[model samples]
Target: MALAETILRAVHKHDLVPKLTRALPWISLLFSFASVIWLLMLPIDGNYRKSYISENALMPGQVTSYFRESEWNIVRGYRNELKIFEGAAIDERNAVVEGWLKDIGLKTAYHRLHDPSVQDNMYAILHAARGDDTEAMVLSVPWTTSDGEYNLGGASLAVALARYFNRMSIWSKNIIIVFSEDGHKSLRSWVEAYHTSLDTTAGSIEAAIVLEYGGDSDYFEYYEMHYEGLNGQLPNLDLLNTANLVSYHENIHISIQQTEGEKLTRNDYLTRLKTFLKGIVSLTLAGIVTPSNGCESFSGWQIQAFTIKVKGTSGGNDITQIGRVVDETFRSVNNLLEKFHQSFFFYLMLGPRYFVSIGTYLPSAALIAASFALSSLSCMLNSGFTIPHFLLNISSVLKFFVMIELSSFLLSTFLPYLVKQTTDESDKISLVNLILLSMTSLVNINSKFAFSMISFSLFFIAMVIVALLILNFSLALCIGLLAMPLQFVQQLLNSIEAKIKVFLCLFVSNPFFVVYITGGLYLEAFGYQNGTLNLMTGLLTSWDDVQCWTWFIVMLGWFPAWLSIAISCGLGDFKNQAPVSYIKKNQ
Candidate 1:
């Protein structure tokens, strides 16, 4: 026993922990950089394979679609009718849709949702002939797209599909056709109502398909499938694969991430990297921003849903053909014995046909997140080993930590309400100025160890990263990568030059600033003229409507950490001297 103890002591005394602590910052930087590079390389030809339907029940493109030239007249007829309600009031338009649904000999109902905005939605259930009303599928179409353009083609096709499917006797699962007034808000209200039993007539939704059609093109040349859902939730890979397969069999070109008609070259590394980064950015934005489509609302309910947007000009399938795609997809869902379990739920889609599954892509995110953990551990160890009074002062540091975090939480919770209540622009400006003045004057005017608060803040940020990773991996990865520099740069803030660099880094990395910059870039890329203010306002509205935590996490969790770090940098120098000296100097 004494020999064993001696060996253990020798091992412990070999300076291994100190060596690791010394090397951790460099190690974390290398790991973070390498992981991102590795992620960017995943879109290469050999790295990812063509996605296949993992669910055997989803025999995509096997059933021949009978939707032919005969349905084209019906689609055209519906489109003609939609023109009358083009600029009508919401109630008038919804009544027209409800009348059309009733004409199909189906029981229809209208739901009035007021999420600080009044909107009306219509729905009808085509109860299955062969089974109980235990399982159901959703066929949802928004009255307007996110761009506020009328989804004329989509709504017309949906009406036609409802009429066509009403005559079919082969369905074993109920089909609920929904016409939402607005894309995200109305669908979320409906879904929430259904789950909470507010809509007693609604059944359990198994899967959902959102149809979004644009342009006045007679023939649909291609489709864009948006699979990312709320909080980084993804629909089953089989669902996406099935849609791609059906599109291919129907002789329709399929695309994703709005990169329609852009062919990827397998041999070019830069092109592939661009494609990969585009996917990452899309996923990250989807998680951080509001729900882009109605399908995202279903994610909160654990229902697998995605949007299939039809795009084209002249030489492809028409509305009838698009309806057939929906027809075939629902038929496959009707064959499922249970919820989607055979395919990956977490994946990064490279294109309509290719994807990198969680197993292949998650390590990149995990490694980046791990870098923060390593840095935190190293910081704790270095402080404890180098500062003799670290233990004695830690209690006071923790008290300050708690106070800061609490203040941050309170600020985040009340600031939006205050901003919203301030109707006058001048009042809002004055309120902001007063708050800034009060905070600056009262909070840290004579405080010592103010710079040291950054270390504790980093620790808090590390915890937030871990929690966020579990909730939304893409979001966590994005934030984690942005905040990674703090881990390495915090120690170097002792010099003015280093402080300036750190301050700049923190400023650029602030979630609010990041959101503004990214929002501007996204608008520019997509050719939208909307400014950053509108985008930020829309994001905040989404948070209020859907209770999305993306905004809260940034404001309450990340922003406070950033503010502390910035304040620390501005206070002059980080006191990395012995904790005894730090405490004595402050006293």
Candidate 2:
């Protein structure tokens, strides 16, 4: 009780007002200090230099490999066959590929993945190894067409890889090569089905490696890999480290490009690229070998998959080289006696090289979000009612909750119908009439302007959402959260016609706006949820993307200008501040 009293006294003694010689709260300073240190330190997490061997057991690029000449011949033959059978349905392609796999001595099983979310068929498999069928690996190739035309050569490569893999006895894990008919959605579904298969006792699979855009028979032009998975999930970091080792050994330009990079820095880029490939391989193994936890199938979760964007003016490594790289990567993964569990998954990559953990960055966003809730609650608390002779404080703060619930219900039930009617050209509704109707629908029975404020706020909120989708999700989340306080503050100022409202807004809005725009962006980019305030946490703990910081400054200055104008109109002059005088002369 004594400690509590002392704390309360300290809080009461320290005022936030200017010109007061008292100490402000230490919490804010602590937060700001932490944010700055984190932002600066994140840039120098330092990427792999020469990709030193993290694991000594696996020796890469040391063995005498001979897939180059023979793989090319097979690739050419498959290409010729595919060219002849072009324009075939996915089923026809799958059938031909299955025949090729069987002929190559690989055990093949096809799964007909039906996705109700978007109707599509995704074919997958379990390729048991020659000796023991204990562990396995996956390789996936999605069909990309040249002018909405399917690239038939992709099937040929999958079949060829299966054949090549079947011939090799060095593989400690069995292989599962999948040919996805649909693109991203289908890949997600196939992974989900594979994970679901583990629930029964029939689980017999291991890691995964997705092959995309592998048609170039010439030098392999592999781009950087994207590793952030669904809801910020990631494959184990050891897989990433092992991949880095392989990239160095193979003398390839591997890069790790995150959402944070504008251009690829060679070393960081290469490490990330190698890491991305390894992630595919490791995730494939995880799906097959680890039961039930590979990919979230029922919940529509997806793996962190990427493609090899082979681009080069001069002809580089051939399909054989790529096959070797894939083979070596699989061999490395097969060397793993356990599932990947040593690396961090929930992390924000400030750059390909740098990252901040979730624990470090979550609080910043939570704090900013809490500010909104606090301000709203404060307004409700202070909105005292007035009677004829006394100030009647009826604490009906719960009314807002009830109103929000009702609004959500109405919007959910009627929004689709309204949208349909709004889009109807035959309805012939005038713009003015539409506006009036929208306004009317928003007006509450008692508090006309109060509800109007909410309605307008929500409408703009939705518009902002649409605009965000059109722009960038991270950008949208920042703008929306930042604008929320301004919208609320604007309404409050308008309600009271308070002269100091502008000053209050400038003081409060500027800082929070910066926090909102800048903070929200980092959070969203780092795969934080779509919360207006959650982004703040990301900003404090994550490396501030310098590009976003520019826009953040612009947003920061916006509210201050309006605030200045409002102040000028309300209290900038003596006349504005003069007390109102009423004179009545009567006989």
Candidate 3:
């Protein structure tokens, strides 16, 4: 009893809250700097590991590919057939593709989907002769990319592979070949329909490969792989490794994020830094750009899928060789008696071979987020220790938080309806609504820096961090780094300098300004024009099609938290009163 009392007295006498408040700014800065350094070091040798196949059942490239030279003739025949449907209507094109699929002796069907747009997706299934309808694999190609270019060679090659697989008797899993119109939208509709009770015939999907041949080039110099999924989810790493293994054996070069074969020099600091920065940028933007492919649609349904895009003009592998690679991959997947469960699901690929796992990169985000939690705790502790009043203040804060969140929710839900009723220009609605909402937030700004409000903001941020880390570590970390300065800015609001506080709070906490400044810096660093607009468009497209959560996180989670702090700081009337002095005065 005496020892416990002594400990309590020591805690009370030292007053840990003041010490933490004084040290928090330094701590946050140190952590942020360290995180950047840690990310920069990830691409160095000994910091990352070479990827390997974890599933023992996946004996990749073990099959002797019988996809011979004759397949090129078949590819040409299908390409010629596709020429007839070049300018045909949607129904006519569907019929042609269906007829070809039926001619290959596969059960074919069409799914009509309407969302932000309308599309028709055609699919076929090759039943396994050796097994019942228990599991299946998907081989899909988009009818056209987002850029509105037809994937003629991709669809042709898929047709040829379907015909070839129909004759093979060694298959144990069924093959579902899909030709989706309008890329991501069509694939998303088909996957959703297949999994739901709407399509009872669709079996459990094991894995999927999406082929995207950009042009009718005689050959591709390399294959560029895309594996990011909706909301920053990734397909199992084993899938990527399996593809890599197959391509390696086929003597085809594989690229990631459009990066060609570049050898890494361990001792060259500049080379390593460049490589590391590229990896970081790719990871940060994965949700926006890389996941805008056909394969990402299946990720939400828990089916492992990725896109293999054929790139280059000459002096590389031909369509026949690429077909062989896919064939071998399917054969390896066919060897699987169970679902993929042996590889890392959470990892960042720096190159074709090197990768950093979750354990290595998660700390960067956690430390940044911790800074906010510490700041909130400091505020609560410095509020003075009148137990009943402190409890009462916390209770009041919770009620206020609930009210504010409910109001924001109602506004967000109804604002779209109001805009739709008022304007026919769908493109302008978002921007106008954003402006109106910003004006709404500026109204009735709270002029008091209450402990409850700060605590609530901190709580919201912590929840966002935890949820976002599970979805996308890069996004969560980026938001945390951006929002860290808000804590210090809030502290400054309690001073007498109203004009400076308003400037810092509005400029620093504004999402639009942050995005603009960051975008400008990005363009300057990379020497790319219109990079910001392209990035913003990609992010919006991903949200509309693939359901990427980056934009939503910014608009809903981070934006609202920052707005609350900004409003309080802008209108609050705390003149030359320190936090400790205010608490004592209240007591």
Maximum-lDDT candidate = 1
Candidate 3: where are CA atoms >4 Å away?
1-20, 114-116, 197-200, 261-291, 378-392, 414-452, 494-498, 514-552, 579-587
TM-score for each candidate, following the candidate numbering = 0.89, 0.59, 0.85
Give Cα-based local distance difference scores for all models: 0.72, 0.43, 0.71
lDDT of 2 by residue, 1-587 (tens): 99999986775566322112111113323433453343334334342122234454555455655666878788778877876656676667667777777777655565554434333333434344443655566666655421133544456666777777667666666666666554444555566566665232123444455554334345554444444343224654445545555555655554453322334444344454444333322322221111112122212222223333333324454555556666676777677676544455444444333444545544433343333333333222222211211112122312433444344444333432343343663354365358645754563333322322233333333343344332232233344344443434423443445546645644454544565553356434534355334433322212111112212222222332223223322332222222211110100
- How well is each residue in 112-162 modelled by candidate 3, as lDDT tens digits? 665545567778889999868888999988877543567778888888999
Enumerate clash totals for all models, in the order shown: 0, 27, 1
Worst 10 residues of 2 by lDDT: 578-587
lDDT of 1 at 176: 88
For all predictions, the C-alpha RMSD in Å is 3.9, 11.8, 4.3
Candidate 1, residues 117-231, lDDT tens digits: the string is 7487788888888868989999998888765678888888888888888898888899988888766767877877777746545467889999988544568667777877777
Answer with 1 or 3, whichever has the higher lDDT: 1
The per-residue C-alpha lDDT of model 2 at residue 544 equals 19
Name the lDDT value of residue 303 in candidate 3: 85
